[model samples]
Target: MSDRRDVWITGIGLVSSLGEGLEAHWTALSTPAKPAVDETTYAPYVLHPLAKIDFDQQIPKRGDQRQMEPWQRIGTYAAGLALDSAGLKGNKEVLATTDMVVAAGGGERDQTVDGAILTDIEKQPNPEVFLSEQLQSNLRPTLFLAQLSNLLAGNISIVHGVTGSSRTFMGEESSGTDAVRIGWSRIAAGTSEIALVGGAYNAERRDMLLLFALKSVALHSPWAPVLADPKGVPTGSAGAFLVLESPEHAMARGAKPIAKLSGVWSERAKRGEPGAIEALVDEMIRTAKGDVSEGTAILSAACGAPEPTSAEVAAISRSGLPVRSVTDRVGHSLEAQMPVALALAALAVSKGKLFAPLEGETLEEAFEGTLTRAIVTGVGHWRGEGVALVERVD
Candidate 1:
């Protein structure tokens, strides 16, 4: 049957504002971080908790650390953990055949101008002093390479010697899910044996902070009602990835199945559409492998917005599956949310526990039904896409 080609999530690695690793991220999301104002000296934007990976331990001894942006570092760290989780450290064949895919909203856009050089060119107060300061500021002629969105995938391929297809997807907040969908399509069509698909985002730059400050999306107080306030958008970094393998390959290699990506569906939100979520969710349920009545729970990408959240609720009411808002714990991780939500679903099925929700957060009663299957929904910004994936454990 067509369902025989199962896409199993074999490993997961995550880094977020909460901390490193899956446990730390889970804890950080579960327990809110203290608030800070935007444009802090140490790092821009203090109101929302920032997810950052410690770069000190990962930098090369003699390489130019400044050349690597924070987004690159985050991607590298998370990819390493994902490979480790998948037990591919020393596997030559897997490394040779594996495909690398990066899903992100938009890559970093931080550029620093040499103050000393500009001052010297302008010939400030004291020529001798200006020249001395400029010379002291590393006057070596070095090539400057602008970081591209594809650099993350390129670097990953170079490090791992993955000569297979290397690509990236940019879908605003839905990029992570879109990347996985691409990876899954490749594996399903017998393109590659294994795929590394996830997303990484860093909001530590001045421009990103200023943008947030201008939008007023950054939560001013940790005590702010994130759910109640349509403006409570937390700014944090997250790298959520999954190592997907075909069912036949996994079973042949004696690898246990974590959870199956039974189906992935997406749709663009039309302007002025009132029931976009309902339409997309209904389509997914109608086309699901298993009956919609068997669906027990749903992991939704509500994005903490009132309209989208209400739309999700209204959709679940029609699907008749209990829905759990995963974004509540992980925040709105943009492109990284796809793999993050998938990882959470895998954990729930692998551990055989109905994952708990934060206090005072209640899903609609219709989705609260007792069943063995669940659907996870993800929605991006106003013009972004809506993605849904179905998972079941009996």
Candidate 2:
């Protein structure tokens, strides 16, 4: 650890229900505003739909755009924004070696095909044969290809020209945490100079709704702040990407550091055991909290699931830091949750102040002091736990 180089966040691209771009998110979070939610579309479940986006600005090719699904398009566009923000958009020299780490889930299911198969399969004589036939004939060849989780990274490479090594992690919220951690670790260890890391999720799909419904973790009609609500997670559509580079590399390119990614710690707690999450969160926070005195707060990605949210709340209480839940504003973007929180944390440290409390004054109190450091905490709705430290670059 002592030999590690300082990793810096040189660029951030975030697109969510609040809006697109850094300025838009800052304006929305800093002001008194309600989260943009759609309660009727997937009733009685609620979700935060993506704000209007102009994909043309990022992915200009019509053929390229047509081939990708909504999630891929979102990720590719966000990656472009990060490259632009880092001053590497057209710099083929730099992009050719810019490694990428992506956190992704399988592609959206074809609900029409799924429904038809279900309806007809029940009446067929040989269910196995009928099912096999339906799968081959009903599903398009391109759909299977689109479902590969690594396509997000491949599209980003093709669209943005980031030709370095590519790695994709798939495991909901934990994948997002590891994507950032791996990228940071590689740069700090001197194995890589720069990396692009993040994830994207599209929440407006019946198949996903059903999947979460099976777990009984889907939020319902009466929406509430994440910390206050015990009703499950209300997923959101979002894409977040960060450009991470070593301090020396950034300086050599004249790229300004948005904030310093000092440390990132990740763990998977055995949720079946009581207090596992709380213990891991406590230890991780203490470890990542090294030497910081004042002007610090926490940006938490506590999805509204009962157990994990409760455990995270208890941990945050013990830390005594002014904490705000990212889920309260953006809804729970499973794979993008951690990256989104880190991006906002970095943005806050750079701006020297934390945004206003997301909900009522009780759970999220106002932070009036100058912000020099921000701790981003992510307690997965079910499994993973992670803590990341983002500090001002002096």
Q: If scored against the real structure, what TM-score would every candidate get?
A: 0.77, 0.94
- The candidate maximizing lDDT is 2
Q: What are the per-model C-alpha RMSD values against the true structure?
A: 7.0, 2.2
lDDT of the structure predicted as candidate 1 = 0.61
Collision pairs in model 2 = none
Please provide, for model 2 over 1-394, each residue's C-alpha lDDT reduced to its tens digit, 9 standing for 90 to 100. 6999999999999999999989899999998577899999999998999999999999999889998989999899989988888999999999999999999998888888877877888899999999788768886634688888999999999888999999999999999999999999999999999999999999988888887887998998878877765579989999999999999999999999999999888899988899999999988887877667589898888888888988988888788788877888888888899998998899889999889886552578888999999898988887899899999999
How well does candidate 2 score on lDDT at residue 105? 92
lDDT per residue for candidate 1 within 194-271, as digits (tens), equals: 888887776555555555556555444333333334444555556777888887776676766667777666666664
Model 1 poorest 10 in a row by lDDT:
30-39
lDDT of predicted model 2: 0.89
Regions of candidate 1 where Cα sits further than 4 Å from its true position: 1-4, 23-66, 110-146, 212-229, 285-295, 364-372, 390-394
